[model samples]
Target: SQQGEEDPQALSIQEGENATMNCSYKTSINNLQWYRQNSGRGLVHLILIRSNEREKHSGRLRVTLDTSKKSSSLLITASRAADTASYFCATYNTDKLIFGTGTRLQVFP
Candidate 1:
């Protein structure tokens, strides 16, 4: 199974600001997804964008996929204190889910 790697291992911002995370993969994938994890807790799926899709959004989350570049990006709009978490990007390779290293986002109020 291949793995996606997120850039800038960590991020910090204040409440009301936005956070952006980028991911790069080594191979083609079926779908790309984003997840958020708080500290040591489990991850919560944020959004999923298929390879054929250019962009998708849910609430404050905006995801964009670029097949040519084998990359994707996640953006959180108007972030809040509760948005603080570790963000990850994942892709489906064959029968497995390959996850990125993750970006730790700290939202300070």
Candidate 2:
């Protein structure tokens, strides 16, 4: 299975603080991508880090991949209320993607 599991089903943080989430997958993947969803809307791609990459950064977001452990983590620095959303980690195969349940992040002002 290409399923990825994310910890802390939910998280609550104050504005300007940082939030971190972790994910673990079962099978091998070509790449892993992070996505964000506001409310019940569609997911928006955040970042894509290949299997060979150890770490990647996009603006305030930083991602680390550990192929040995088959896991990854995402960190959002200096977050804001606008960052309140559901974050998901998706494992990509040749044909499709398998998404984690997601971590619902609530940023309070």
Candidate 3:
């Protein structure tokens, strides 16, 4: 499948702590994107890293891509309770976006 799968289907962290999640896919992709979805809300784009790039960072989030392994990882630093949400990794195909089942993160104060 072109879609990816993330580990730790769920994670819980205390406020001010860091959280990391890993994703693995089966096929190559032009680009990979990470998104956040608040409970019952639409997804909000967090960051996107191109296949040619090895790593990228945005605000408190860090993303790494390994094309050879068709895998990626996301790290959220100093997480806040407000950051509690479901995170998904999506790969860009020709005309559609393929997303993983998603990792549910809960940040507790």
Candidate 4:
């Protein structure tokens, strides 16, 4: 599949902890993007890593892409209770995006 799928589809962590998510795709991609969705809410874009970039960081989020391996990973450092949300990895393909199933994250206070 051209879609990027996240591993360990579900996660639960305590506040101030770190959460890591990984994605694997079947084909090459121009770029990879991470998104967050609150319960019953639309998704919010988090970060994007181009094929040429080995790693990128924004705020508490870090993303790494390994084009050779057809995989990527996302790490959210020092997660907070507010970070409770569903996270998705998407790949850009031919002017459109194909989103994977997603990872459900639950953060407890």
Predictions in order: lDDT: 0.90, 0.94, 0.92, 0.91
The residue-by-residue lDDT of candidate 2 on 32-65, one tens digit each, is: 9999999979999999999989999999999999
Cα RMSD to the true fold for all candidates: 1.1, 1.2, 1.2, 1.2
What is the lDDT ranking, best to worst?
Answer: 2, 3, 4, 1
Poorly placed runs, candidate 3 (over 4 Å): none
Q: Relative to the unseen true structure, what is the C-alpha lDDT of residue 50 in candidate 4, on a scale of 0 to 100?
A: 89
Lowest lDDT 10-residue stretch of candidate 1? 1-10
User: Could you tell me every candidate's TM-score relative to the true structure?
Assistant: 0.96, 0.95, 0.95, 0.95
Better of 3 and 4 by lDDT: 3
Give one digit per residue, the lDDT tens place, for model 3 in 1-109.
5388998899999999999999888777899999899998999999999999999999999999999989999999999999999999999767889898899999999
Q: TM-score of model 3 relative to the true fold?
A: 0.95
Q: Model 1: per-residue lDDT, tens digit, 54-87?
A: 9998988899999999999999999999998899
Model 1, residue pairs in steric clash:
none
What TM-score does model 2 achieve against the real structure? 0.95
How many backbone clashes does every candidate have?
0, 0, 0, 0
What would the per-residue lDDT of candidate 4 be over residues 17-89, giving only the tens digit for each residue?
9999999987778888999999999999999898899999999999999988999999999999999999999
Q: Relative to the unseen true structure, what is the Cα RMSD of model 2?
A: 1.2
Leading candidate by lDDT: 2
